[model samples]
Target: MYIPFDEMVDTSRVWIYQADKQLSTAEQSQIESKCNSFLQEWAAHGQALKSSFQIIHDKFLVISVDESFNQASGCSIDASVALVKNLEQELGINFFDRTKICFLVNGEIVEIPLNGIKSEVKNGNIKSDTLTFNNLVSDIRSFQTDWKVEAKNSWLKRYFQ
Candidate 1:
C-alpha cells in the first residue's frame, strides 16, 4: 500500500500478515524488521524528511508526518517524481502506477490512466490539488470492508485473494 508522503496526517497502521498463521519468533521478527526498514527507507527519501514512523507488530505499522509537503514548490516536479521513483526503487514495487490502483478523493473516484501522465476522475471533477499517499491509504482502509465484499462477488476475487 502506497500512501502519498504529503497527505500523511495522523499515524496509520495496517496488518501485513494474515491472522490465521502462526509465525515463529524468528519469522515474525524478520517481517517486523522488513516493515520497519520499508518505512525507514520511505522516510529517507528526499521529500520524506519530515516524516516519522513506527512498526507496531508484524502486521501493523504507523506513519506520522507533516502534511505541508503536499504543496509543490514551483517547478520542482522532478523532486516530486524523484520521491516516488525512490520509493518504487526501494520497495521493489511500483507504487505510483495508476493502472492497477484507483483513488477516491472526497467521494470522487480518480484513476491513474494507462499513460500515467494524469488521473481520470470519475463521478466527480478532478481538482487541481496534490493528494498524499497516506490519505489514499486511509480512505481505502475506511472502505476496505465494502471493497472486500465487492471483490469477493466479482470475477476479480480470485486474483485479489
Candidate 2:
C-alpha cells in the first residue's frame, strides 16, 4: 500500500499535481496526512499498490506508484483523481489547473500564466537558463533528473527559439 517515497524504485510511475498557489504550512500538513491515509488503502483490482508521494516546494504534489508490484488500473487511477478533487474543494486549492507555469527564481517559486509566458520571457524575467518545473515527467528517474529544467531545454524552448 503506502511506502516511503525513497523506497520506490526509479522506474515508478509518477503523477505531478501543481497547486495554483503555494500551500501554507497548515495546508501542507493536512495534505500530507490525507494522502497518507488514502494511499494506505489505495488498491488496484483488490491488490494493494505500492506507492508513495512527495510534496515539493509547497507548490507541487507528486504521487508515485511502483507499478512493478501492481499496475494502477483505470479505476484506481480515477480514485486518486477523486481524492485530489476532494482535497481541492476542502482546501480551496486548485491543483488541476495547467495554465500556469512554475519557475524557481532566487529560491522562490514564481508562477507565470501560460498565456503570459512569452511576455515574461520578453521582460527578461524568464531566461533561457530559468529553472522551470517540468511536471510532464512520467517516471521517478525523470522526475528526479528532469523535473527542474532550464527553460531552453523544455517545451518552452520553442519560445526561446
Candidate 3:
C-alpha cells in the first residue's frame, strides 16, 4: 500500500502532524521506519490504502493517502490516531499539540505561543511579510502551494488586520 510520494499525484488527501519540538536524527530515522511499516498494513475497511509519509524540517510529519481507490473509514482513522499516540509515548514527542504557532523568521521556522504572537509582531520579530506554515491544508496541491504562505494570507489574518 505504500507508494512513492512523488508518483502519487497532487490530488491525494494530506494530514500534517507537527511535533512540539524538532526530532533528533535518530528519532527521525526510527519514526520514518515506523511510518513505512504502518503504511504497509494500513487499510480502510479491509481495502488497502495507498499511503506515504515523510518528515519535513525534522519536525513536521506529512502523511498523504491516495484515496481514489478506497476511502479512509472511521475505523482506519482511529487506528491512525492510535498509532500516533503510541509514537508520542515511545518517542516522547507530542504530535497532537497545536498550541504552538509556527512561522518563518529569516527563513527559519520559529515556534511561539499564540498569545505571544502579538508581541513578536509588535517587536518587529514578525512582520507583515512573515511567512507562516498553513498546516491546515487538506490536499496535496494546496500542501505543495500553500503550506508555507504569508501570515497575512493565512488563518492568522485577523491578527494582522
Candidate 4:
C-alpha cells in the first residue's frame, strides 16, 4: 500500500512491560527459551512449506500436487492456520496487523488506525486491498489496493521465476 506518512492517524501506542516488574528471572528465562523454540519450529515449518510449494503472496500460498502427492503429504491448511493463531496469541503479536503498509517519514514510523477500516473480507473481494478508514479515507483507499496488488503480483512472478 502507498500509505502517505502524513496521512497516518496514530491512535494509541502499546506500553512495554518492564522485565523486573512483570516476570521473575527464572520465569522470564523459561518464557524466552520457549519463545525461541517456538520461533525455530515455526521457521522450520515455513521453510519446509516454501521448499515444497509456490508462495503467491503474503496472504495466499498454494501448492499444486497430484492426488498421490496430496495424499502422501496430507498437509492441512486449517492446522497451519491454527498453529499460526496459537503462535500469535503466545507471542502477543497480531500477524494481520503487521501486514499493514507503513510509511516512514523523518526516521519515524507512521501507522493508520485500523478501528474504522472496513475490511473487504466479508465480500468475495479477498484480493482487494482497498481499506476504508476514517479521516482522509478516500486518499488512502487506493493506496493499499495498488501496493498490495503490485507487491503480490511481483512476488508471485519472482517466486515462479
Candidate 5:
C-alpha cells in the first residue's frame, strides 16, 4: 500500500529519477497525487506492495518499495516505468536522461551535461568537493547516506584525477 516514506524500512529498494529541470509547485502537486494513486493500487502477483515516494529538490523523484513485504515482479517494475513515461508525456519533462548530471552549487541545484563535466571541472565550476547527486543508489539506506556525495568520493572522481 501507500506507506509514508519515513515509515518505510531503511533497506527498502529505491529508484531515483532526476528531472531535466525543476518541477513547478503545480507540477509537484500533480505528481504527488498521481504517485499516491499509483502506489495505492500497486501490486505484485496480486499482493499489495508497500511503497512510498519523495520528490526532492523539485528535481528528483525517489521511489521506494518495501520488498520485504513482497518482491516486485518484472511486470510491476514495468508498470512503474510506464507511470514515469506517462508523466513525462503529460509534463514534457525528461526523467530518463542520464546525461544530465546534478550538483549542489552555492546551495542551488545545477545540472551539467555529462559531456560538459570535464570542461566544467577544468573551469573550476566543478570541484572535487562539489556535492553531486548519485542516482545509482539502489536502496533507501544508501539513498539516504550516499545519494549526495562529494565529487571526489563519487564516480565523478575520475574527472578530478
Candidate 6:
C-alpha cells in the first residue's frame, strides 16, 4: 500500500528519475496522481508493497519501496518501468535521458549536458563545490547521501584537469 515518503525507512529502495526540464504545475499534479494510483496497488508476489513517491526540484521523480516487507520481483519492477513509459507518452516527459546532469550553483539549480561536461568545467561553468546530482543512487540511503556530491569529488572531477 502507499505510505507517506517520510514514513518509509531510510534504507528503503529508491529510484530517481530526472526530467530533462522542469515540469509545469499541471504536469506535476497529473504525475503525482498517477504515482499515487500506481503505489496504491503496487504489490510484490501478491503482497501489498509498502511504497511511496515524491517529486523534488520540480524536475525529479523519486520512488521508494520498503523491501523489508517484500522484495520487489522482476515482474513488479517491469511494471514500474511500464508505468514510466506510459507516463512519458502521456506527458511528453523524458525520464530515461541520462545525458542531462543537474547541480546547484549560487543556491539555484543548473543543468549541464553530460556530453559537454568537459567544456562546462574547463570553462568554469561547473565548479568543485557545486552540488551535482548523482542520479545513479540505487536506494533511499544512497539517495540521501550520494544523490548530491561535489563535482570535484565525483565523476566530474576528471574534467577539472
Give the best candidate by TM-score: 5
Model 3 segments beyond 4 Å from truth?
none
Rank candidates by TM-score, best first: 5, 2, 3, 6, 1, 4
Candidate 4 lDDT, 54-125, residue by residue in tens: 111222121221222122132434443454455446645453443344322233323433331133223422
Q: Candidate 2 residues 38-89, lDDT tens each? A: 9999999999999999899999999999999999999999999999999899
Report the Cα lDDT for candidate 1.
0.36
Reference-based lDDT, each prediction = 0.36, 0.95, 0.87, 0.29, 0.95, 0.87
Give the CA lDDT, 0 to 100, for residue 152 in model 3: 83
Tens digits of per-residue lDDT for model 6, 1-161:
89999899988999888887889999999999999999999998899899999999888999889999889989998888888788899999999998788988887778888788778777988888778988878888888878889988788888765
- List pairs with backbone clashes in candidate 5: none
Give the per-residue lDDT digits (tens) of candidate 3, residues 4-77: 88877788998899999989999998888888999999999799999888889887998888888678888988
The lowest-lDDT stretch of 10 consecutive residues in candidate 3 is 152-161
Instruction: Report the Cα lDDT for residue 93, model 3.
Output: 92
How does model 5 score by TM-score? 0.98
Candidate 4, superposed: residue stretches over 4 Å from native: 1-48, 52-75, 98-101, 114-161
TM-score per prediction, in order, is 0.28, 0.98, 0.96, 0.27, 0.98, 0.95
Candidate 1, residues 1-161: lDDT per residue as tens digits?
A: 23453455543322121111223466445544654455444432345434433332232233443445432233333433454355345544443443443333564333444344232323223333423122234322432333222322333234323
True lDDT of residue 129, candidate 3: 74
Q: Candidate 6 local accuracy as lDDT?
A: 0.87
25 Cα displacement, candidate 2 (Å):
0.9
Q: Tell me how many residue pairs clash in candidate 1.
A: 8
Question: Which stretches in model 1 have alpha-carbon errors above 4 Å?
Answer: 1-25, 43-45, 49-139, 150-152, 156-161
Backbone clashes for every candidate come to 8, 0, 0, 0, 0, 0
Instruction: lDDT winner between 3 and 4, please give it.
Output: 3
